[model samples]
Target: MAELVFDYLIIGGGIAGTTAAETIRQKDQNGSVALICGEPHFLYSRVLLPEFIRKEIELDKVMLRTAGDYKKNGIDIFLNESVCDFNSQTMTLKTISGKEFRAKKILIASGGRPKLWNFETLLPGNIFRLQTLDDALKIKEFLSSRPSGTALVVGGGFMALEFIAILAKYGWKIKLLCAEKYFWPDFLDETGFGILKDLWQKNGIETIFGREIKNSAELDADFVGVGIGLDRNLDFLPHAAIKPPSGGLEVNEHLETGTPNVWAAGDVASYKDRFSGRRRSGGNWSGAFMQGRTAGLNMAGGKESFKNIPVYAISHLGVNISFVGDVGPFDEKFGVKTEEIRFDKEKKEHIKIFMKDNRVIGAVLMNGQRFLGKINQAIMNGWADSKITLD
Candidate 1:
């Protein structure tokens, strides 16, 4: 066992941990900082993993920061260190490789591992879960061979949809099944989802929603990819602290967890949206980066607020989709001016916009052309509640 002390110890090398470290260095140049990441590669965007699989993006392009960048800032980086446990009383942590480190404050940005099926035996080699850069590279290799047969994708979300879109373009038989009736249910309403359904079906990808995967052993395919969501990697901490059992670490408006001197960020952390004040969980890259920066600033003895306007975006099947501010559920509560356009009703071209007062609170477009910059700006500038007169 080895012992060391630092001003801050960040557990997780993902975007959250990286941003936290950078933010800390930006604020306090004299304090010691250490970052522990399980993966050997530098910090990369987990959201772009699917796109990397489709060959639409190169590995180097999506990688934002490198380990060397952190080291230059005087922050110690530990790669390939898998944390096994943490003790708050001693302010120490033990890794699976039988190493120990002590610090003044710890930030758990370890993130989450993909949820895999609990099996009595090792599942077949064809099954895959895309949670890391290596996983995406492996899938890329698997697809390069152009293995004969269709892909059965399980789950419904931004990642699942992106996977289906990219894989379908590669000329592989694709069968997408989800347990929800609509795609991106959290962001898109029934009308918006209907538009996506039409586009997906038109592309020759069959989708079945609101259905559970009863058994995978009976099903056979050239390959299977599952995106059943993620669970917060909080087994090392007491369960009672984090409320809302569905999400990961729990925090107040300030992003502080139940444990003293322990803060959380990234997909592993859940907090209230600044606008709606409702508990929200976002596994997206933007959310993780922002949260990590806020946590780091706070940990470094700076007084900063974590409040922020909601932001989300994705590109699939030539459709660029983005959402900002309080959308969806807000449509019902707020009397927003709503407009919809369905081009070629039979062809499934539609776009819907929800404007509260005069600002854009939400929108959905599928197989249609509509620039999103204006809408996103309106939402962030607090113009969503203004009265508008369209030209």
Candidate 2:
């Protein structure tokens, strides 16, 4: 029944929310700012969690900020607190612990969570998902305590690849089981997938396709690593019908939520792309961090639009896999066309371009090339992809 008031409020404690808080302080120092964090710990790097789990980096390296830092900046951070109810009409948020936070403006940076199978009820300790720092710590601990054994990784994205790498290093038998036969068929072309598949085989990692894990025991894995997908954490959104086409909070170029005194950023924002005019959500850490800055600027009485070419890159299985822009579901309905090319024959480098109306919209590259900058610029301006040359 405690009531707190602030000039501005941020819901997530990830990079987005933390960056937004810092940006808000820079813009309006006197504005009372309150950040409600669902996690008990302060901000940390989600991108580094994989490296930490792999033991390539120390746990202390993952910590990005301390409570002292927030206090120094005059930001009130409520860790281990989450909103249970939201009243958009009054701009009021009720926490799970019955604390009320009233703010003149609010930001939604709640991000997303790993999608897990309900099998946790049957085998709790064996099922794992790597989405947070805690998840990485627990996974590392689990591996340290148990002997190397068969591991089943169910996913087709970056997280699944990370799990494979970590398990393989631990000298465990690893099998990648995903429902997609061509993994990222939307963005990655046949050659890109072929390259990855070949690399997987070279590393002695088995690949299983067109399958779903209904029974954990049936897979014969000592444990399961689930990275099937990321679900937007909209639990605080209530039953309100404000969801956008991307399944996150709908936002304009300025990151405004289209609701009075509200804005959204990071993984939880389904913002209209400044280039394509299509709505999409960005999952990469850099994208979230920049979006938070843009949202913070606008929320502090300045008008600014978020415009960044979405880029995601990861080194896995002895190759560099990079994706830019809105890859697949290019919506043939929108007259989208795709082309794949092997840019470097000797190095086995490949690129796939997805376009509509001859404008570059998205692309994927394996063993990526230097021309990535041109691709980004072309996608940003909706420029004709014809001028983008590998040479």
* Deviation (Å) of 94 in candidate 2: 0.8
lDDT of each: 0.74, 0.85
Number of the top TM-score candidate = 2
TM-score of each: 0.85, 0.96
Model 1 spans with C-alpha error above 4 angstroms: 118-122, 326-391
- Please, what are the lDDT tens digits per residue for candidate 2 over residues 171-261? 9999898888777767776777778888889899999887777765665788788887888888878646356457888888898876888
Question: Which clashing pairs does model 1 show?
Answer: 357-386, 358-386, 359-384
Per-candidate alpha-carbon RMSD to the true structure: 3.6, 1.5
* C-alpha positional error of residue 349 in candidate 1 after TM-score superposition, expressed in Å: 6.8
- Per-residue accuracy of model 1 over 125-174 as CA lDDT, tens digit each: 77777888988888889889865577888778666876676678678788
Model 2: colliding residue pairs: none
Worst 10 residues of 1 by lDDT: 382-391
